[model samples]
Target: MARRERPARVPPRWVVTGAWRVHRAIYRVSGGRVGLWRPKPGRWGTLRLTTTGRRSGQPRSVLLGYYEDGRNLVTMAMNGWGEGEPAWWLNLLANPEAEVEVRGGTRRVRGRAAEGEERERLWARWREIDTQLDELAALRSTRTAVVVLEPL
Candidate 1:
């Protein structure tokens, strides 16, 4: 069988981190008018996820890329394709319940890591949107968690 080639390396960590910071800053400066977007055909959308901080017990919000699956929203804890787990994922693990702001409005959600065949299925779905998904995931030492946000 022919082996699939890996995608090019991602941008420097600082670049990736800085981009996210800028995105969040725009969301903040706009007073929630211009950040979140809806998923269009063959592309993922952006949403603002508000997860309670695991240690601080404070509301922590971050913008994430997600796509709708049935009535649920699906995302990956890729952490900018960095090595360690993202804080938002850890916070979700600590407290599964959270809130999300999408293009439509706010919704209360329960988060969980997809596993087994469910995970494989969702991963495949993501791959369709992101052709470099596997290559980016391979940069990390551990498997990225495919997070499913089910409506409460």
Candidate 2:
């Protein structure tokens, strides 16, 4: 009898390090078209956020989700099963002044920490996506702020 060859797998799972790098690649590949949205958090859309370079003061675009609070955008650096935050989020930490690009449009946003009522409201929404985020939120909740996009 002849030996049979085994079939190969269709597609391989991605093997990469760094949360933001994985995040950026996913955004680019999908073109920010598809995302799984659950009601608890309202919406989890494509990563099309643009932030300013910490040093150059230029624009930096990446994919991310925005939780809503009336007209404001709520976001976080939630890396599932990971402990550290991403570089982009760190960049925002370095310089809260940043921008975001979404659906072919752009917005200039100023990052500031949410306080009291604002934090509670956004935290309620944040809990929806990942429960693990609660730990992160607790650490960042006070310092966590909304990116208030202004007319540019």
Candidate 3:
């Protein structure tokens, strides 16, 4: 795993919120061009994830930092160092089918939580790239979900 800059153990809620607003806006405004290229200090390459809302049945989109595992796209449900699972992860659990855009290309994918050894391997990979993994996890009570998106 390549070393990468990591975020603070627990980022301020306002910073997290503000960053997301800016990231999402850039992603949408450029039609998945600008946001995916800028790898921020604590983030890797960004991807635009579109998931079907569990209740609203509407499409919900978010910009996330992600890594690649073979053909799968990997990301954490940390919600920017905040507590609980993010809505995108919850939505994926309800309906695993989703679409993601990376480097200006879109693909259909099915989401699943990595389990046992697979989870361990992936988590270790994250730790290697992100020095703040443990500290970030400590900030939250619940374990973060390691989500994998496999192309369909």
lDDT of 3 at 1: 100
Candidate 3's residue-wise lDDT over 22-81, tens digit each? 878876788655778534444567888999999999999988888888889889998887
Model 1 residue runs over 4 Å out of place are 1-6
> Per-residue lDDT tens digits of candidate 2, residues 91-124?
7777776766655455677666567886676677
Which lDDT values do the candidates have, in the order given? Answer: 0.95, 0.56, 0.86
Top lDDT: which candidate number? Answer: 1
Task: Estimate candidate 1's alpha-carbon lDDT, on a 0 to 1 scale.
Answer: 0.95
**Per-candidate RMSD vs. true structure?**
2.9, 10.2, 4.5
57 Cα displacement, candidate 3 (Å): 0.3
The TM-score of predicted model 1 comes to: 0.94
lDDT of 2: 0.56
